[model samples]
Target: MTAKVSYLISKPVVTINKGTHSIDAAKKMAEHNIGSLIIMDNEKLIGIITERDIIRALGKGISLDLPVEEIGTTKNLITINENDSIYKAAELMAKNNIRHLIVTNNDGKLVGIISIRDLIRESHVLKALSVTSEQEWIGSD
Candidate 1:
């Protein structure tokens, strides 16, 4: 059976308010061994912060005390619903060339996160299928 996004996404998402400091968010990411964190306010989706955001702040010499909103990428947050298939999620990742996606509930509340690593892990199963198909093709030929 094809895997689904829900199967791979990390739930009980660690989130932050946009007002929270980038350093604080970075600390949470490190503590959780996660690459990204959802930014929200009163249960509404707002933005996202990631390790990359923290790096960019360092590059700009921005203070660690600065709010994550000041360093986070605000535009083009790619989100997915829990019910969406992994196929669709993978397509979105390829289209956006992004490594992570924020998963949302039916009411659009942040629920979890999925990453390319999750999809690539699934590819191993698909690879096994491909090998089987290739062997079958060779035998037929």
Candidate 2:
């Protein structure tokens, strides 16, 4: 069976308000040990913040004390449905040059989040599952 984005979901997607200080966003990411944080406003998913965003801000000498959005948080968030194929998720990420993705439900509500690392890990599982045994391998000397 082909894997789906739902299979890659890590529960309880972390989030932050757009107005939160950039430094606070960084700290929140560190606390969660996550690379990105979803940005929600009025119970609506808006955008996302990542370590790279913070890095860019620092490189530009932007104050970490400023609102995270001021750091130019990703305005266009690329999302995938939880039931969508994992291959689709990977394709979107590669096409967009992004490392993270938000998983939404049928109602377009945040269900979870997935990262490139998750896809890589899932790929290994798929590979292992594909090779049931060495005898099943297609290659031969």
Candidate 3:
């Protein structure tokens, strides 16, 4: 059975509006202990600004005082529905080489987020189980 995205997306999301400054986004990122925030406007999922975006903006000498829309990846967005499978969500991340994904509702409102680290943590648990299983098999044999 495919794991549902509802089990993976981070809830009670921290979001930013297009009018918000890059500095504000960075501050929220740190305060929320998250690497990215879903950008919204009028309760609609718009864009996303990640830690990498903030760093790249700084590298280009862009002012933090500028709006997040100035630095956010607005050109190509990848969003997933709430009921999608975890495998599909992971596939999207692998294909896009992104660590985070925006979770949207039927109306495309920002709902939550999922991260590559979340998937990695799951993989780690499975690896531990696999190791234990192998150990038991060896001992029994």
Candidate 4:
């Protein structure tokens, strides 16, 4: 059986206001132990800022004090529905070359976020279970 993205929505959504500075956004992410923050404007989802965006900013010599929206992944925000299958999520991530995906509900409301790490952890569990089942079958044969 395939797992739904909802099964991995264990954490609360960490968000930052759009006008927030890069340094502040980074601080929020660090404080929450998250890799990305949903950028909002007046309680509306506007974009997202990730560790990669901050690093890119540093590489370009951009001031960290600048608003995160200036460097956030805004133009083409990649997102997935919470009810989607994990396999679909993985395909979307690979297709877009993204490490994180914003998870929303059928109504398009923000729900949670999923990362490559999350998918890998789930995969490890599934692999272990499969191996254990195979071992049991072989032993019983």
Which residue pairs does candidate 2 place in steric collision?
none
Query: Which candidate gets the maximum TM-score versus the true structure?
Result: 4
Question: What's the TM for model 1?
Answer: 0.79
Q: What is the C-alpha lDDT of each candidate?
A: 0.81, 0.83, 0.82, 0.87
- Order the candidates by lDDT, highest first — what do you get? 4, 2, 3, 1
Question: Could you give candidate 2's per-residue lDDT for residues 88-127 as a string of tens digits?
Answer: 8877997999899999999999898999898888864456
Give all TM-scores, in the order shown: 0.79, 0.83, 0.82, 0.85
Residue 19 alpha-carbon offset, candidate 4, angstroms:
0.4
lDDT of 1 by residue, 1-141 (tens): 656567877556778997998899999999999888888876777888889888878998889898887788678788898788777787788798888888877887777888888877787545755776799999997
lDDT of the structure predicted as candidate 2: 0.83
Query: Which candidate number has the best lDDT?
Result: 4
Model 3 pairs in collision: none
Lowest summed-lDDT stretch of 10 residues in model 3?
121-130
Q: Which regions in candidate 1 have their CA more than 4 angstroms from the true location?
A: 124-141
lDDT of 4 by residue, 81-128 (tens): 998888788779879999999998998888989998888889744675
Off by over 4 Å in 2: 72-74, 124-141
Point out where model 4 deviates above 4 Å. 124-141
How far does residue 124 in candidate 2 sit from its true spot (Å)? 6.7
